[model samples]
Target: MRKLLLLILLAAGFLSVRAQDVSLTKGWKLAIGDSAQWASPTYNDQHWQAVNVAQSWEQEGHPGYDGFGWYRIHVVIPSSLKQNAFLKDSLRINLGSVDDNDEVYLNGKLIGRFGGKTGDIKTGSFYGPRTYTIAANNPAILWDKENVLAVRIFDTGGDGGIYGTNFSIGMADVMDHVTVNTEADFNYGERNSLSKSIKLITTNHYDYKGKLAFKVTDPETKAVLYEKTNDAAFSVGRPFTYSFEIARLEKKSYTIVYTFTDEKSGKEITHTETTPYLLTPYPSAKPKINGADVFGARPDHPFLYLIPATGQKPLTYKAQGLPDGLKLDAATGIITGAVAQKGSYPVTLTVSNRLGSKTKSFTIIIGDKIGLTPALGWNSWNAWGLSVDDKKVRISAKAMVDRLSAHGWAYINIDDGWEAEQRQADGKIIANSKFPDMKALTDYVHGLGLRMGIYSSPGPRTCGGFLGSWQHEDQDAQTYGDWGIDYLKYDWCSYSEVTPANPDLPALKKPYQVMRSSLDKINRDIMYSLCQYGWGKVWEWGAEVGGNSWRTTGDIQDTWRSLSSIGFNQDKAAPFSQPGHFNDPDMLVVGKVGWGPSLHNTRLTYDEQYTHISLWSLLSSPLLIGCDMGHLDRFTLNLLTNDEVLAIDQDALGKGASQYLKKEDYQIWVKELKDGGKAIGLFNLSDKYQTISLDKNDPALKGYTKFRDVWQQKYVITTGKDFSAKVAPHGVMLIRVEK
Candidate 1:
């Protein structure tokens, strides 16, 4: 009986030891100014502002002050507690959130410091809470009697405070520990109810020296599924990444628990994360065409479409079953093969990624060939600048359709500044006196067998200070659709007010999505062109946003200098253009006489103008003549109506143009056609006529022993390894060769 009583007493003593409490709510003193006297132990802080230990001084009434401030707290260690207890050595002081920067010290010994200025709207900054550790070597930081913990904070601007509420002095074991951040949150790709391999990433930030063990278990059933451990050593401030491939997971929710220990301190940290393991069946690996219509498919040509996978990094795509000689571009998803052997063929495509793979298939029924080249067009911006009006547009449309329709020009576009002052009500669009009848004008253009294009901005004001489509996307789209507008050019200028200078994808996505959805609902077939001047990688998602074309460079002016600058910029965007969508280098500036306070001011010479047209044609840009058709001189008419010059721009083979040779003042451009022929352009950018020579060994001239000068209508044969000729300043020599 006496032994039993002794056992009960021992149990009581153990319970008491476990229930012991430590109070961290004590005296905190603060000092201001340049005096270091507060560091002395004898200095009295009784007269200083008294406050709670874990509180924001700024919230309590410190005003008009944002700079360096000092905070000190005195903590007492109970005599009953042993100096070497693990609990006493594992204490930490968390200072929530500090503006700009901070440093912590225990009894004049620095513990830890984080330095940086507050975040501006442009750059991100220190957010959330910060923590500092108290090691065993500095036990005096919280001594047996009185101890002082000091903190120095610096605030440059904005609200200076320890943001968010909870601040405490607690034992490290009492707080949740994270040895590694949660990595594998959900299964990659499509989720299903089948067992599959799962990959996870583990990051180790703590200074730990031991094996890290990971285990997955069904939280509800308490059944362990997978377990693995790795021998990893991590130093403080250094992060290490570890990947684990675990298999045999079904469609169920599971909890992952990971644990690690410090070899020297014998301290262990454990983390738990929960995620769902889905087992959805994989999608079929066959090509499925989208965006095509119900008309019977043709052997020679048929419109085929497919929506590329969204949210994945862009991919290179290759397709088969196109007419024999044509080749498809895998990187751009463009079908570029020539339909030489006319017969129906089944089309199939396979898309693969690092994670997995997918496939799509369709039928291409070939028939008698129909020409699929883009329609030749004319835009008024090059001819009239901001002076385009109803009378000018109507007369030009009639003249172009009457004179150039037989030569393949089919679109007449009215560029910027078509809106009137009455539309200024509520800053929305309304046609003015110049366009008294919008529908009549559209009909007038259509009556001449031509399509009509108009322009506006995505913001509240256009570049010409006219009404834009900011808050009126749907209204403006409906208005344009009602007026029978065939194409719309949406520019981005005042839109920057709502769009931050450098914004993340999410911030810029909503505005673009709104405009796209509105246009699609208004008229799905309406051609939409986006003009954002190449900002925000708009080309990456321009097609998804309902854009048929997008401006990839700044505005082009009527000069060889401006034209060449824009021409070079087009090279970077070559990879993004496809059959329906294109990269626009602004409008053509061939006939504009200059705008700003100048009359009939011809900026580009006749040779420069020829070079501009030659480059644009070879580049396969939209053929929008900016020259005024009603007032065209004989020279301008001859340049615009040359059938041989138009053939290069209307090439059927859809291949990107290339620059074969480039010097300080000259360049050679060429495009290859599927018919074993080529179009070559030689340009001289200097002020004086210069002798130009072509090397037969160059890739551009390799297949050509003889060529016809299209403009001169004369055939020339090469005599030796090089052909030399004198070209006028800013002159271009356009030639067609049959290999």
Candidate 2:
């Protein structure tokens, strides 16, 4: 009895397998060459080359001539088979590798066609095969007895061949009998090991309703990783989104398998794909060397890069390590403390994400040392807009070095509008009358121990309509190099018009690629500052395109609102900014009085200006002063020449700017320097003088024991928990703290 039951079960499984094999793969003949009347039911091709089904013309060596070709396959249905066939049957033809494009015909009837050699598809491109389906009811398609099928192809370039794949005729006996396709298109977005999180986007085209189920699985282990079932009867065009978190897995190659099935019909289809996943351990949170103080402070604030783990999100730093006066924020990734005695201390940080957890270890070295503070520089835009002339530029350069060089002011940058038609023809770019002797001017600046910086728009025209380096990228770059131009600020103005508003990044990145390539070819050593004003997150690909610095915000005017607005937008972009390539928030608006073609001269009170500088300094922005250094007032000179304040802006570890206090009209910002010190700025925006206090207990201020006014060169020795100082309206106070 047991053997009989086993036999019955075996018989059922065998019958099921045989039933699926009934699919139409037999009784088909193919022919090559194009004929206008090949689609006619009565068409005859007795003399044409004969070929077997499921074969490509290329495989037979008679791939046919290029340009245009045709393929025909004949199928006959017997009267008995037609009567036994299920209703509403469908036949699918899979044409593999048609040079550029092709059209198909079945039983002397036009079935379907797909264009392959047109548009972005070239004759010899990485294109996949195409599949077309046709209804089986038309009499023109023929029901039985020697039916003919034909396909015409057009190839523009490269080898023209047909690499055919699966071909079949399927039937649907009931609504649930429809086949479920398990194909999905995927695109990977931004990813980083520091934030062990990656975005996986997939587009599904099959009906996932009723008994159909969609599932993602691990191919190696055959583990069901993620799965989803459609509750709604969604149509074939509906798109679904699924976000999955793959936990702590070692760096390795993995396959994502997708399966679709109609449980009611027991019909299913599965597709698998493999992608690389690299897992990197997070960098040590605390510095390895201790006893090092930043910004001339006693016990220095910790300085180090925070490496993200695979799939981890941005860290939320919390204070940790050291004595009661020291703390680090795990959420903000900031370490702060004040030390009476300088010594080395070990530091460690714990990082966690959805994937898993890891600890980073290092040490901080504290010491008393002083080095050449980074220089302050002047940029032309703030003082003179389109009105800048050759004499005006020369005069500014001389003034910056003659009066401010002793104060550590070095580079003299000639912002936009310097490329006057004198340098080149076509009015696109050239040194105009502004600087007839461009080389001489650069030489003169260098002679004064100051570097020279020039500006040009990345577009066809500069913002002032002066000469620009658009298509002439290499030529313009060579011109700058030849003229001994030390720095290049490539602005993106009219270029924005060419850039798509909502760019399909994958499609519209060619222009930027070209520009970057051209710039690198011209001069790789020249500082290439990309000024694409944050369009489509250009910074994401800026570094790859040879940009040393890219703008993270829109064009900024000199105003309290504008400064604060641009300052706040820096948080999302803070991670991408590093040494060599920095985030530029436009130029400074310090000395200028908001006059001329310049945007509103930051109507901010002195205090507000201080806040702006503090924020920019902490943010590690390129300190290219836009004010007139030639006529620097006492107050303006002091603001521009503060060595202690400038040290934070040029910290070796590259600390990011953080807001310690935020108010509508007042604010405080700070930057942790390499040493156990801090660059702090307090600003007063209102007309009335306001007294601001620094809270010792504040997490950002945790590592400071004594305060020194950097701009005034005065020290305030106080161990109190808090300290206060009065700031004049529209004025600012820049300071460094020692622990």
Candidate 3:
């Protein structure tokens, strides 16, 4: 019976394994041409040039060169590497991320491939991290000896080469080593839930006779409030979970950490998660108006505005002292009409719920200026990347209307990947199959009282290698105008190809000038946005080129470094901010943003998210939501619906915030408001809770003594000349002060 069972199990093919990786960031020879001999181990590569694989070859000394390239390297494989108690029998190859296409080889044998030639079926293998298994013990590995690894790459256009951080050989799934889902294991948003869960999952064949330790620390004082340890054993992909009630813990955020020690491997892995509590309080159930108090429109153009209000359901809206030809839909709180006259009109907008009623003084300025305040809307880039489609866009539009329209969200902008592969015979650009009907889509959004936006580039191809305006600027602009595109994000992706070698400022301005002229010829107003990544001090010349907003930096990631570096460094461009013109530091990454169809919650901690929204508002930067609107969470919604916080960004004065005080990682930035008040952001850039204070003598808080916590919407009492608070790590104290 035992022998029969053994035979049954053997035939079933069962083996549990885990993998660790060896980073191959160095030692590579690159050449421009591809030959079959290059894949062989015996090929002499001494004459091949050494190159950095982190970026494209164009950025690595070879400029404007795009085509086939060969990368080769050699490394010795340790014989004992496979001997790891839990490691898989076969080695897994990771080529990192490659542009276009790639086929990797080991000892002259093709092991794995990506992109079109591989028949991947999946279109984004080149964009995501790739792992290919050697399928059990393969002779091509040549263990305990030097082995050659070669990569053949095919590039069509734009950026090309083998790039990304991870390039190595591992075993099985890298996550099999350890993956801690902190949010899933804990009651992060449930304040009344006393039970706390902690999970330890590993799929290794070896039973980790490991010790797992859990602890909670006071972030401010570094005091350990709870501590426990358990001798745990786990195998066969089952998660070892530990749960306990933390009713003893306080309401504020505390640092929770878990450490796992594998006795055999002697590996110590620590996972830390912060802010398992909610800070942004829920808005009042009673009626309250929010968002920009001021609105703008072009003379006699189709006018629409949603009275932004937050409260319980069944809210009523009314507008008084309105200009002629405008009507309000009390049922939907949407005002739609076209005013022939161009002037400033003050209207009192009121919203009432069962609990109470709130009124706000609103202004409508119909003149040449548009985008009077930094745009508050959504863009498709972060959530869906190049995979965005018409269906996804429609879903986003409906979501914005249902959940976010009441809080002043507008503009359903499609970024990249919407253009047809080929333009029309008449030189007019058209939407791709993904967006079957661009005109109808615009009408759908406009009918919902929301504006529609489109994207293009000054080059022949966009960043996603789609059709751009290029030399046919007039035709493309005319096409967009005919479709009633309200905004245009003109990227400078492949436009560099047309620029002169070591081009001067004039050459840089030429493409934008061409597009601006083309837009001017159109019959309607389309907000021109410059997406040049803030190179060469664009703020000084952006308005002159007819740009409503210009990018001040490269793309923003969800990491703290990306957020701070891009947001805090906008002071140089602050002086140039004004009505109808603003500095853009990229879109908001506060929600789930994966740059593709697969979305993940932002890596920013809860505190970091507050800092992100606060600093962006202070900078007067365009607030473009780059998340999947269909996946709106309560916490993310609250973070966005804070009327007091958003009012700073929409201030009519349009003066950007300046860094008034900087102390290492602690900073205080202040922006002037249109109402003789100042919006102040006291940011703690450090990793620890810090006592951030403002002195009356410092002048940033001089006569601005009647202070109110804008985020909390409560006035505070302070004595003497100092105002202080123990701000959380990567958090901020947003306040509005007046004399």
Candidate 4:
């Protein structure tokens, strides 16, 4: 009886040591200003705003506010917990995280300090875990009654106050004594055969003496692809790495399970992790090539003609064309590089994956440079939508010539809504009633020394349900050239409906190829702009299909979310931009823009407009004005007339800006200029004003440099080692740095 009682007591004691954590997410009272009296336990805080401990005070209606704030909360010590001998002696407090810096107080006594103020303001780790112990020797802490907890926070900029989800206040040994975590080497890939390294860990130094088992199961079928077991023991401070090898896996998500079973107690525990293997083209129908029976290519300039082919990926490509210096990429079916010879070269292109193989014949006609430096133009979609007319277009052309032509704004693009509802009997699309005569309108615009552009779609109807060049690519191209249209905006609208279940390379490339072939047959040199809304990563193969520029996103709205989303997404598309071909983030939504019959000023703020223009310029996107040229405000005119600012967009190097420095809401974009200079845009996307500084010591900047403010159009200040600027919300500071 004595032995049994001892065993029972030992088990009870073991369970009693488990971690008991108290969540401090609720009952927080926040005050905007700092005060020493607020830290007192008897101080009244009934007028303070209620705020969650897991979110910033800035998110709770305190926009753009920075500086000191105080938060207080009441935590009642339960009778059962206060009497506990272990917790009565020592208590551990987990404050989660505090922005910039913070100081904690328990019952009016200073308890802990994480960051800030040791004479000068010192930077604190924003992500560092806040775990402090209240030594059992402290006499201020009340154990038998309600306890007061207070925190003083300081925010330098952006979001301020305690935030994040891992907040908790608890006693020592109140958390799980043992915790398991797993880590893997490779979680994503397209390899047919590969090996993975995995590591397993357990906290609290608990020795795991058990039967270890490993299994890989398909997520869809739950079929076990691999399984293994071993008698193993894991202990803290010991290496625990396991290697798993797979021969091949179909393209899909898979679950990996690792289970441990104790041999003595029969207790079982399991841990799971997920990973995926992506195979190209995926399994589809048989492979086949789709394009014109004959194609054309030019010499001396870059030419891209994607060999459109449908079916499975891992597709092998081979071409019989004898054009010197030009070759086809087997993986993407894109034939690129400058053609050395101008003569007609009949080529047979073949594509084959594991499924099947097919071939097609085409021709190449290489010509002069298409897009020299990203096209500087004006698009009508933003200003007028489908309410455009011949008169509105002519007025816009006049405005461009009078107000912006000298600033290098040339192309005057007429977006959708110009086409009639239906095509003629001969399959030729005609202008709508608003556009009386297309040829006459083009001629009038051309006489003003401005190029005229037209819009169309590969589908039967456009976004506005207007006539499109579906089966009339050849006829439409001839007609457009006859009308002297200098550019074409080809949008993707209803095309997806009539295509195959899953669009492959051939399906996407066929329509564009048809237009390219048609344009090649014409005498005029038309700049092609693909408006496919970035589907299929058009930047990779857009130039191959004769596109001078391609839309990298859907559309841009006059809002911060729209501007930030479209601008930041261009980070990945920079690699594909070059001298002739560029990435387009829709049209610039600056100045006045609204659907016709009710036109009004743009909804974007003054600062946001500057950011929009700066980001688009740095992104190497086409600077197409999406606003009413008929009514220009002085501010709008000033925004558009800065040649120095626009010069960055027209840089001859054709390099897009890269985000070299990103910290919270502040981003520094740098673009290499043709003259060995660099154009930098210091942007603040947060609601609060932020001070941005960069020094010569920064790895991104090398050697001594001079600076010019592109927007202010003057050199404000020069610094040898560092430079700083206080920027407003959604504002951009455009600077040109020269060595």
Candidate 5:
């Protein structure tokens, strides 16, 4: 009797294990090219490509394919489970996620379809999870036999397949089909946005009503901080969010417990999660590294790169793969040492606190060449938006050569509105109606002793909605080289539309790498400028991708709010600026900005203009004039022609400025000059006049310093270690200090 009981228990265990969910991972046969006959159940797929279910077709032998394909697999249902309670009630199938869209068929019989010709799928519907119910009495399903499941998938680009975490066949049990998800495992600071949700799913559209109770409490103290109860009803598969206005709680872990009781069956379910939050206000002190993905250093120069990480306190850092002679501070994340090597070193940085830790990978290039100084040029966007024409461009080039080139200015860049509505038959981008001949126009600009710059996107369209160099990167680079183009402003624009969801740094850097390779294949030297609006901290690795300058901020408008926001934010990115790659703060918005057809003086006041020039020059930002040169007034000309001021920007030292001292609305910005001198700008950002002063003994200004007013062209004798002046509202006092 004991032996018989043990056998029965073992049998029951085997049945329970078999009743669990089955994920369709293996045994998938993929047809590379699309065909209507491939969807048939009788089609012979013996010689087809074997592909994994939870992976992109792009990785499985279809590198750049963006079209229709078919995947077939046979899953067997054991005959012994024909009378199983789970299958007898109902069975549900989850196909997971596809790239763009797909149609599912069971043994050549159409069961359901989504995100394609069926008209139910929207643009990004392929990313949505799919779940369908196979009722107990459904005749389409083959129970206790071999079932052939075929899926027809349409991929627009990138990865396409049945992918992600949950692609399985399981029993339909609505009683326990609730899953909870939170935005992050941990939370920090009061400014952080947090979200928590509970997904309620049911089979056969079963209506479920239940009571949900949520409570958040300190694990150690058992003190309730947040508590709420609500009624939850589900007629379909939808996620309901719980409102959590996180308070400024103490820096300690808190447990969130969830309880659910079914209204009909009285079956209770509970789940608990823990999250820790810091109540620090805006501008967190947490450790954070700023700038591009890569940093450049000379072979023999003393390299000092500080990882800009901030947090409350007691934060420790560790670095792996540091080259010889370089050392990192475990407490500060400051890397200092003279680099004598000339190779790329992949360095991993980790910052840990009492709460948790964060890690990031960075590259230190010992020797790479490109940006000698901040680029000085004129872009047509601010003056003429999408109305750029060849005649206007030729005139601008002439002005650069005749008036601006003598003052260390070059690069007459023709911004957006240049490409045609579509690419040529051979996949080459051509000039639009506004610009008749691109090659000839480039030659004209080149012949006038000024280099020419062109604009294009990594995607299909520019910001002006014209054809861009997406898939035709190499062809467009060759065309630009043939036309004598000297620079390329590659914008992000439509590329964001096609980018994968939550694209990693490698994914974001791939397009730039493709364009870099394209440019290297050409003979002409084209300066690459990345315009991804500072996404992914281009400053850290802009040089790695051959970017001479990377946009560190978004597009700059001609308003003070826009200018100040972009200008003042450059302090954190100062250390990343070097000879080959500088942090770009978008185009200048000085002088007269027509933005095409209608011209008006810049909205900035005279004082604001001075502040703008002083800040940009000090920050070592690319000074791209975004105005019509033909309409330059004397004041605007004087503002642009200050060689003394521009000298600080053109300083060979390549050290960007930093706001060393900020007292109230008065800020003191300092930049190291190449000649052992320092350029300082005392700025008043508030309204109304204010008296600003700086201690002459400040490190920015060595003791016993003599100052020269660059804008005024005068010298001021210094006594002791003090300097004070009444600065105009929204104005700057730019001076050079000689130690």
Candidate 6:
């Protein structure tokens, strides 16, 4: 009995001991002033103000404060806390994401530092998560006593301090052997399985021999669909990749569980993917017209507008009451010619086939403004990145003409990497060898009734280290104008290389102003786009700098987290948007995206994709598709070609979505339309299906009792004062509310 009791006690002790993390999210003392002596553990912090370290110091009553700040943490480390960790020798602290830069100190010694300004650029890893691991057996650690941690931070502008969620310290464990990408994949091309890439970690010293199992179950039925087990081994510097797939999935979700067991340590790591793949139903074959109701261009400039329509093949097109200079091709739906008149000429556009006929009233607003509404088109960055070439661009243009142009998709904007390695001695930038004939490419796009756009930087080099405008802003502008470029994405990349570090607002606006001046001198109406990642609140001064659109955030990635954060956080910049100017939240992350030569299916689920399109339309953001046009599937095409959704974005009022109601489980954003109606996006932010109910008399509903389901294209009758919907998780129900 004693032997059994001893064994039970040992097992209990072993079970109690684990790679447990100690949270340091709360109870941290902070001060604005910085000093090196504050790093010392013995320093008196009795008078230091107590603060929580979960978010920016701005929210902690330090609003409008910028520059340097310091934070101190005090905690006790028990010797028994490291018991069950196989690699208990090392300690790790996660401070999450800090704006700009930071330096971590423990016991008066610098343990780690991340991101800093170099040269004139105020460079920092503001968005990168911060995780630092202390060396094994480091003397700076107080094993069974008190410890003091000091963090020094610097913010160039805007929000600052220790921000983001992960804040904990834990002993190193042997099971940190793999990282499974949480941004699950969906069907696009021939491949039709929900997949996740599990990469074996090669940073630790221990080798891991384990059994890995993949089990998939019907989320609603709780019945197992597929199961598999495999013996796996991993070691330092060993490359490993594992993927999971389940065939024959329906519209419903599937629960994917991955189980990994270590043979020697007896540790098991399990990951459950509650819902993975989703497929948006394909559109019907009936005729439908898509695109902006209003089109604008400078008088005498080549006017090109494709009657964007979707339906059966061999569709016929016609325009009634077109101006004398305008002409349309009946079979191709292409309108070409220039309007010398400087006035609004209303035209009735019609498209028909054997299946059905559709007609819409479109206005040819020939005047000074071009992008009166946001530009809907495709860019090459997320599709080809620096590998964009003439052949690839031509292929994209052909594909856009074949499938997308009929849906109002336009510009074939070539992103970075088109610049030549050098400029001519006479000072003219040229395209690289990949694009031997730039003007011809532009002409080809224009011939197809599509516009062309190009990218450049205000610094000595672009983001891709290619030639930039620099002192030759006018020269480059003239070159783009001569090349028939209709839009300019002026990236503020290496411009920091020319200016001083932590430049003032004037210096920040200088480069864009210079380019704007150059563009004004040119005869073409080139739409100016400011892409400084929202530094200095660009939305407020964007139009002042002659900008037609300005990026309001950083680059967008194909994941639920990236999409939700960027889309939902647009209220701050929405008010600044209006006609001929818009707030760009980067490009769309749908379709096949890889940011390189190779591409794969996007990591966003079907529901999240619906939310993405609906939100962007309501925000009135410039819709720039960031996927390879040659690889577009039916679902992505549906997401882009929704005429009603596109109308919200192309409204003549040019207003963006404003958060009307927000709660823990859901949110409703409302956008005003030109027709006195309102577009509302009912979004579910929870992890499970939620029923969203709203009163018809709500101010956002504008006393409207009748509504049309925009996506479903059906009217929904509400008998009572309230209307409701059973929204899927990460899903959206977009509707047009009217009397």
Full-model lDDT for every candidate: 0.57, 0.52, 0.78, 0.69, 0.69, 0.78
Segments in model 2 whose C-alpha atoms lie over 4 Å from true places: 1-375, 420-429, 506-513, 522-524, 538-541, 593-603, 661-666, 682-695, 725-733
Instruction: Please list the Cα RMSD from the true structure of every candidate, rounded to 1 decimal place.
Output: 30.1, 25.4, 7.4, 28.7, 21.9, 8.4
RMSD (CA, angstroms), candidate 4: 28.7
Candidate 1 residue lDDT tens string, 137-237: 46545446777666766543223445333345544442123235442223343233222222222232445567677787754457787888877666645
For residues 225-344, write the lDDT of model 4, one tens digit per residue: 999997766667764567777757763346678776767545456666554332112223577664333333345544444454556456688898648888777765566666666566
Better of 4 and 6 by TM-score: 6
- Write one digit per residue (lDDT tens) for candidate 3, span 1-739: 0000010111111112224455567888898877889999999999998987776676687654545798999988776667663545667666654655678889999987766533641222233345567764788988778999998886544345776555766555333446454544244424444456767766455666689888878888899878999887667677787776665555456777888787876766677766445445677899988878788888777677878888998999999988997999997788988888999999999999889889999999988888899888999988888888999889999999888877788888999889888988888899888988999999898778788888988887776767878999999888888887888999887676677654578877889999999988876768888987776688999998889999887567677876887788888999999999999989999777777766667878778888899999999999989898888776688788777788899888999999998789899999999999899999999989888898876777777768888877788788877988778998888999988
**Predicted candidate 5 versus true structure: per-residue lDDT over 433-514, tens digit per residue:** 9888888888676555566899988877665557768889999998998887878999866575677854678877888999
Clash number for each model: 27, 77, 0, 16, 23, 0
List the candidates' TM-scores in order: 0.49, 0.46, 0.81, 0.52, 0.52, 0.78
Tens-place lDDT digits, model 2, residues 579-646 = 55567777777765322343222334344555666677778777777765555644456555554555
Q: What is the lDDT of residue 111 in candidate 6?
A: 89
User: Residue 478 error for model 6, in Å?
Assistant: 1.3
| Top-scoring candidate (TM-score) | 3
Instruction: Judge candidate 4 at residue 304 and give its lDDT.
Output: 45
